[model samples]
Structure formats: C-alpha cells, structure tokens
Target: MAHWNFSLLFGSAVLWAMLIPCRAFPTGAPASACENMLPVHTGVQPQPTRAPYEFLLSSPSFLNGQPINIQILGPAYKGLLLEARSFGSNAALGIWKTPPNNTKFLQCSGNPHGAVTHSNTNLKTRQTTYTWLPPNSGCPPVVMFIATVAQSREIYWTNVKSKVIWKNPKATCGAQMLTRTWPAAALLSSMLLILLVYL
Candidate 1:
C-alpha cells in the first residue's frame, strides 16, 4: 500500500509541475518578455498629443509580427479611418475606413490598399476595434497608427506608435507550440505508463 501511494504521489507531482508553465505563458503573452532584445526608445515623451476628438487607443508596446489588436474609444463620429503606416516615410501598410472607398489615397506602401481583417464599431459607446496583420518582410522597426474621425464635417486625428521586434515565426512560434503541447503529451504518456505498471 505504501509503495502504491508513493507512485501516485510522484505521478501527481510530475503532472502539477507540467501545468505551471502553461498557465504562466499564455497564448497571447505580452512582449515584455522580449523587451531586452529590442532597441530602447528613450528620451522621447511617452504620452501622445491629444486630438480634437476625445479617444483612447490600446495596443502592445512591442510587436512580434503577430496580429495586433487596436481599440479606439471616443465620441461617435460620422466617419472613422484607421491606418497603419511605416514610421518615418508615412508609407501606408493597411487601412480601415468607413464607406469602403478604394481611392488612391488609401494605397498602402505604393501597393493597392487592402481592407482590415476585422473591424467592429459601437456607436452608442463610440468604441472601435481593429485587427491588423503587419507585413512580416520589409517591415520597419517601428510603425504608426493614425486614427482619423470625421464629426459634424470637421476632422480630428490621433496617432499611436508601436515598436516592431522581428521574430522568426518558425523559431518563436515553433518553440512556443512545442512548449504548449509537450507537457500535455508527456503527462498523458506518463499517466498511462504509471497505470500499466502499478495496476
């Protein structure tokens, strides 16, 4: 009986240890983990200049070519345009605007404009959400998001900038993918082997 209990306890400990890392590192882990790997942007004021329209923008401080989540909050406007552009050259990369216009002004990086993957707007609360996939190749170290609003025939704009950290998908995602699955696989195999031996 004591030997059986000891085996069970050992198996339980192994199972518990495997679960800790998965919970600690979630699928959408923050970029803070790679902060030291990227260049530090210092001596620049952190706060963005306020625009005529009241708004709030939420985005990660560091990007690793993952789909970026962008949220905008402000008063309801007649029209809203969100754009992603190269940091210094003002070259467009992607755009999301109301009315679905495909004019020359909407072109991205001299290429034809492409629509945003997902977009949602709540007029009552005046909030908007957008998902953007930045180009993996030839992308700059930093990118800017420009949110423009047209309210009552007047235009208001806000800018939010993010740092881009290049991560080889094969390396980063592959390792994380293994990390997420390896523990579960090992746990199952260990539990089955233990059962076969003990029973």
Candidate 2:
C-alpha cells in the first residue's frame, strides 16, 4: 500500500507538470514568443510626394521687347495654372493652369483688369512652353514674370519663383538672318535722285 501510494503521487505530479506545460506553452509561452517575433505588417502604401508643377519653368527669362519663352523641362505637370509675373516691369500675367500648349501663346483676357498675355500663335514650341510677349516700345518699369503652379486638393502644394532673365532679340536672332542688303546700283540711283531733287 505504501509503495502504491508513492507511485500514485509521483504519477499525478508528472501528469500535472505535463498538462501545465501544454497550456503554458501554447498560451503563455506563445504570447511572449510571438511578441518577440517579427511584428505583423498591416499593409504597405505609397507615401505622398511633392507636386510635379513645382518646377514648371526650369529656366525663365524675358526679352524687353520680344517675348518670354518658358520651358517646362521637368517631369510633366498638367492641370496646373501658370501665372507670369514681371516685377521690375510692374506687370502681372495670370494664366490658367492647363496642359502645356506645347507651343501656343497665352490668351489675353479682355477685362480692363485683365492680365497681360502673349499671342496664341507666338507661344509655339516642340517642348512644353508658356510663352508671353512683353509689351514693346516702353518695357515695364520693372518686368519680371512669375509662373506659379496651382495646388491640387491632393497631397501636393503649389510652388513659384522668378529666376528667369530677359532674352533680347539680339541674343536670339541668328547672325545669318540679318536684314537684306540693298544693291549698290539702287543705292546710288536713290542718292542721285535725292541730290537732283535738292538741286
């Protein structure tokens, strides 16, 4: 009987120990094990970024009498309003944010307070360009055009700056494309005619 009681106690103790580990290993041990293990990822989404229109005119410049051609050299930025500001000239050009006209002049509004504009025909380019012909004869007191990109409701915001220069016709015109030369005979004949008339 004494031996049987001792064996029974030992067996019961082993059974309890085994059962405790079964419960602890699955629930208690696994809870901590999982906690230490790599965490579960919810999901991966793309983070929002800056707007494309932030840099519309990579190089901006103006010609006192001619025109101002803006090159949209950066990634395509459509649906953005472009406003050209000529500060020293004290002029404001407000252009709608639209797909680059490729080569189309900025339309001038008829409103008295309307912003100045470049002829639609003049704004032509193979690349994306916002063209504006500054008024000639009397250049703006201080002309500086600003192309502002409008912000969308999305995560992006608008950006603007004025680093453009004044590109004079002299700089853009080719040397070979100069005015035609008058014939020597025609010049002499005209001179003789003028001299005869004076006499």
Candidate 3:
C-alpha cells in the first residue's frame, strides 16, 4: 500500500511539472488578452519591479506608409506583446510589416494588425526586431511603443512604454494601392472576365 501511494504521488508530481509550463501559454497569448493586455495565466500576477526590457527605435520620427524598425533590448525573454499607440490612448495603432520569425500579430482594437506577440514561447531571445507601418492618413503628432515582456510563464512585466516619437510634418503619405472607387474585389472580377474571354 505504501509503495502504491508513493508511485501515485510521484506520477502526479511529474505530470504537474510537465503541464505547468506548456498548458497556460504555449501557443501564445489569447485574443481576450487584447483588452487588459494581461496574459491568460490566471492568478499569476505581474512583477512589481521594473521591466528589464526596453525599445530601440530606428528613428525618433516615423513617416506614413514607411517601415519603422523596432528592437527589443534586454536580457533574453520568452515572450512579449508589443503595440504602437498614442500617448494617452489604449488603442493599438499602425500595422506590422512582416513580423519576425516565430512571431505573429494579434487583432486588437478592431485593427487586423493591432499588436504583435510571439508565436513560439519556446524560442527565447534578447534581441528581436519588428517593423511597423503607420497608416497613410490618420496619425497623431506623436506615437509611443508599449509592450509586455515575459521572462517565463509566471514572470512578466506589463505596461512598459517607450519615449514618444514625433511624426514628420513633411511626411508624404504614400498613395494607397487600392481605394473605394477601385476596390480589390472589382479588380479581381475584371481579371476573371479577361481570363474567361481568353479561355
């Protein structure tokens, strides 16, 4: 009886150890996390101490429709959620231009590219670069980068904000490839008609 109990307890312990790391946040943070910017690790609290992470922008100012390079600097971390925003606003701004390897964007604030998060929690790195593209027309005079860095499943820092960057007043917002007058669907239909006639 004692031996059986010992084996049962040992198995349970090993199972818990294996599950604790992978189950909570293996794939990535959930879409629900967009609102509060909180991880789904229920009951686990964020670190009160300052985040070791910081942002390194390619330039102090950004231009519309152009890519701005952003780098996260610090000791290696397991995962992160990064977003560009106005100083006092919670909504995420801009679109991600080709996210880094092992990462993907989350649809937050109704924007398809609202926030960027790691797609693979197993890959840990200190230096990762992300590209952000501001919308062509709507932009505040200044924008900031905010992020939540996770060192592990239970250890993370939230609301890490960078110094604001001004928008270039002389920025020439690039011409959009598509517009309301010439929607993408209409273009697709035209191509199909041409193909059918040729066939």
Candidate 4:
C-alpha cells in the first residue's frame, strides 16, 4: 500500500513538471519584443485625423508573417512618421521609414529616403499614398496605423481594428509542434523518474 501511494505521488509531481514548460515557453508568437512597452493613456483615446487607410497586399493572404509588398492610401506628409502598432495595446510594431530619433520601443529600421519611396501623389486626383514592406517575422494578428509628426511630437492613431492584415501561420504551427514533442519528452522523463524511484 505504501509503495502504491508513493508511485501515485511521484506521478503527480512529474505531471505537474510537464505542465510547467508549456506555460513557461508560450507557443504563440509575440507581436513584438517591445509589445505593450509604451505608456498607456488614461484619458480618452485620441481621434484620427481622418478615416484609416487601406492596406493593399500583393497576395490575398500572408503565410507565417511572410514579407510582402504593401501600399497605403491616406493622408501622409513628408516629415510625418508612418508606424504600425499592435491593435489595442498600441505597441510599436514597425516603421515605414526610420525616424530621425528612435521611440522607446521602435528602432530606426526604415529607409532614410522613406518619404520619397512611401509618399506619392496622384497627378489626376491629387490624392497622396504610401508604400511599405513590414518585416518578415513577428507579426501580430492585427495592427493599426500611427502618423507621428516628428517636429511637434504629435501622434494621430487610427481606431482599433482599423486595418487588419497579415496573420502568422506559425501561430498555429508552433503550438501544434510543441504539443507533439512536449508529450514525448514529458513521458520519457516521467518514466525515467519512476524507474529511479522504484530502484
């Protein structure tokens, strides 16, 4: 009877150990390294200058956050910084063009001549547009746009879920992959521990 009770207790401990890794190492990909690093505003959320623009992609859908060419149609100026932030949390995602100065979370990874590449006007309609290519990895499910004026440090942010594009196929794969291996590893460890305890 004592031996049986010991085995049950040991097995329970091993099972608990197995669960720790699943929680510690999250299978889901984080939106960014600097996710939710920015200061939160307690006051009312600010309104955007105009309706959020559309994000046009070459492909109908993205795979595992793969790098894709994109174009934007909206109000953009020469000095304003076009940044992508995770929806709701507003964590810095990526910039269309590197800013003259880096934000708390965003690095200057944008093209120096980004304004020229991003901003163009239609000669016929006088509408301004921009183009950007987000990084190939670490993309969240959804993101919103922010137009930041460098000189005045003013920010114009789109409404939450304003522009939804790009989902990571790896988000599903990572979890499944971890589940496949984790059980095997945990079983092996548990068996070894049980054997040692019996001996």
Top candidate when judged by lDDT against the true structure: 3
Q: For residues 1-199, could you state the per-residue lDDT of candidate 4 as single tens digits?
A: 9999999999999998876544311111122322322112223233445544455555543444343444444444222334555556544454343312221122333323222211211121114334344445555665444443211113334232224554554433122222444578899999999999999
Runs in model 2 lying further than 4 Å from the true structure: 1-61, 88-126, 150-152, 167-199
Best-fitting candidate, scored by TM-score = 3
lDDT of 1: 0.43
What tens digits encode model 1's per-residue C-alpha lDDT throughout 58-81?
A: 444324455656654556544344
Show model 3 residue runs off by greater than 4 Å: 1-23, 172-199
Candidates 2 and 4 compared: the better one by lDDT is 4
Write model 3 residue lDDT over 1-199, tens digit each, in one string.
9999999999999999876755556666778787677887766889999888788898899898778888888888877888898867888888997778878888889987988988887665656789998877668889999888888878999998888888887776533356467789999999999999999
lDDT comparison, 3 vs 4, better candidate: 3
Of the two candidates 1 and 3, the one with more favorable lDDT, higher being better, is: 3
Global Cα lDDT for candidate 3? 0.82
In candidate 4, residue 35 scores what lDDT?
33
Q: Count the backbone clashes (under 3 Å) in each candidate.
A: 0, 25, 0, 1
Give, for candidate 4, the lowest lDDT window spanning 10 residues: 117-126
Q: TM-scores of the models, in the given order? A: 0.41, 0.35, 0.73, 0.37
Worst 10 residues of 2 by lDDT: 24-33
Residue lDDT tens for model 2, 1-199: 9999999999999999766543311101111211112111123221245434333343344443444555544443322333444453323343333334332223333212223222122222226555555443434333344332212112223333445555454443222334778999999999999999999
What is the lDDT, from 0 to 100, of the residue 97 in candidate 3? 76
